[model samples]
Target: MLTKFSVTAAAEKFMRRVVRFSGLPSSAGFRLLVRTGGCSGYDAEFSAEVEARTGDETIEVHGLRIFLPAESRVLLDGLKIDFIETPDRSGFAFIKDDQRSVVAVSADVARIDVSAIGRG
Candidate 1:
């Protein structure tokens, strides 16, 4: 389980839009999977899912239901998630509580991970 996980307002808003427009049922939640990748400590893939996958734990940040796998839960411990959008790009940025972005996953590359590949 995560010892600490936080999301900024912008990140929350972004997630809400994703869920609301995902075309899934109203009960659908955002599924986030993170792994070690590249120079940064993390790489992430996310999607709106109708429900948590097997072995996933559902956590609520405010009202958004987030589905996280075991590895992701450990990776997200003590991190804060934020959303950043600019003229050139938009994506979710992961930051340690006392540092800058550890990794930024591009929205353009975000995809559904039904296969659970590369997890852990």
Candidate 2:
């Protein structure tokens, strides 16, 4: 169990939509691999997979199955996942309580600096 990880409502909805449209079976799960990178010390890549990979821990959150490898599980602990959208981009952001760091993951970009984001 991931006791310290939390997913915001927006993030949960986003994840559900991704799985629903992934063209995989209903039992498919979202596989998230996280590592240390980006400005916030969190870099993530995700995809819909038919099943959890070997050694992956499957977690059910609000009916959505998420697959996390060992590294991801540790990195995601104590972090909150949220979805953020702007006119120019939309993606998932991992945040901690102090809000000092954020890692953005999107289809078109690998990393984004949260400090540089502003209404334009």
Q: Pick the candidate with the highest lDDT.
A: 1
TM-score of each: 0.80, 0.77
User: Clashes in each model (backbone N, CA, C under 3 Å)?
Assistant: 0, 0
- 11-56 per-residue lDDT for model 2 (tens digits): 8887776677766677888777888776555667777778999989
Q: Candidate 1, residues 7-72: lDDT per residue as tens digits?
A: 999989988777777767778898888888844556777888889999899999887999999888
Each candidate's lDDT (Cα)? 0.77, 0.74
Output the lDDT of residue 113, model 1. 40
Instruction: Choose the strongest candidate by TM-score.
Output: 1
Candidate 1 segments exceeding 4 Å error: 100-120
